[model samples]
Target: MVDPSQAGMVAVGAGLAVGLAGIGAGLGEQAIGAAAVGAMAEDEKFFGKGLLMTVIPESIVIFGLVVSLILLFVF
Candidate 1:
């Protein structure tokens, strides 16, 4: 009992949510990753902090995927 137009719109929205989030995550990570590498290059002890910072942006993608999944099932 799903309307085709509604379903298509939901699908498009889900795709956009996931794709844009992924792109944003990638861009966010790129800057952080560069800075992390630079810091690590300057000091060996910065590795742990750098790694943690580098990974933090990955949560954006996870959130986007969760939203996309919810949209896929909820609608």
Candidate 2:
């Protein structure tokens, strides 16, 4: 059986991993989204590139999820 303290620590770790990564991703996306919007406003042709750039920060959340899963199931 898992010790209560260990389980709590693991839970905290998982939460932190996801929470911090999400915050980081949000910050990154904010800047990229602003730039993307500006570029799109300047040129409609920039829409695709803008969208791609904005979505790039989403990978950070994905990585965080993976780490959380690992902490929950593998530790």
Candidate 3:
């Protein structure tokens, strides 16, 4: 029911929100994975902590996905 201009703007906003979030998540995970690998390589005892830290990025991704979905449905 939206006019073409408004609809386009909304779609653009949705795409930006989701796309930027995804990029952030990807960067976060890459950093964590690298750190985990580095830590594990240096010391085996770091396994637990490294794993926890690495997986922490998953929450960022989940949050982004949730926000994207909410935006899609709510708007």
Candidate 4:
């Protein structure tokens, strides 16, 4: 069997990976969703800004992916 500490670390790492990834997705969706709502409430012209803002969360996911990769390699 695997070492308990090692297994615990793995679990922690996985939790971090998933949690961070979800956070990233949530962050990404938050702005975009907000913008969408604003646009819907305001003018159609806001569509472009909303779209741009929505995609802005992609960076967080990218960072999370990098962290995950690093963890995978190290672990």
RMSD in Å for model 4: 3.6
lDDT of 1 at 50: 96
- The TM-score of predicted model 2 comes to 0.93
Candidate 1, residues 5-71, lDDT tens digits: the string is 7899899989999999999999999999999999999998999999999899999999999999999
> Which ranges of candidate 4 are over 4 A from the true structure?
1-11, 24-28
* Candidate achieving higher TM-score, 2 or 4: 2
In model 3, pairs of residues that clash are none
Candidate 3 runs further than 4 Å off: 1-5
Q: Against the hidden reference, what TM-scores do the models get?
A: 0.93, 0.93, 0.70, 0.63
Poorest stretch of ten by lDDT in candidate 1:
1-10
Query: Candidate 3 residues 1-75, lDDT tens each?
Result: 556568767677777777787788789889888989998999999999988987776777677667766666676
TM-score of 1: 0.93
Ranking of candidates on lDDT, top first: 2, 1, 3, 4
Order the candidates by TM-score, highest first. Answer: 2, 1, 3, 4
Candidates' lDDT values, in order? 0.92, 0.93, 0.78, 0.74
User: Which pairs of residues collide in candidate 2?
Assistant: none
CA displacement after TM-score superposition, residue 22 of candidate 4 (Å): 1.9
Per-residue lDDT of candidate 2, residues 1-75 (tens digit): 557679989999999999999999999999999999999999999999999999989999999999999999887
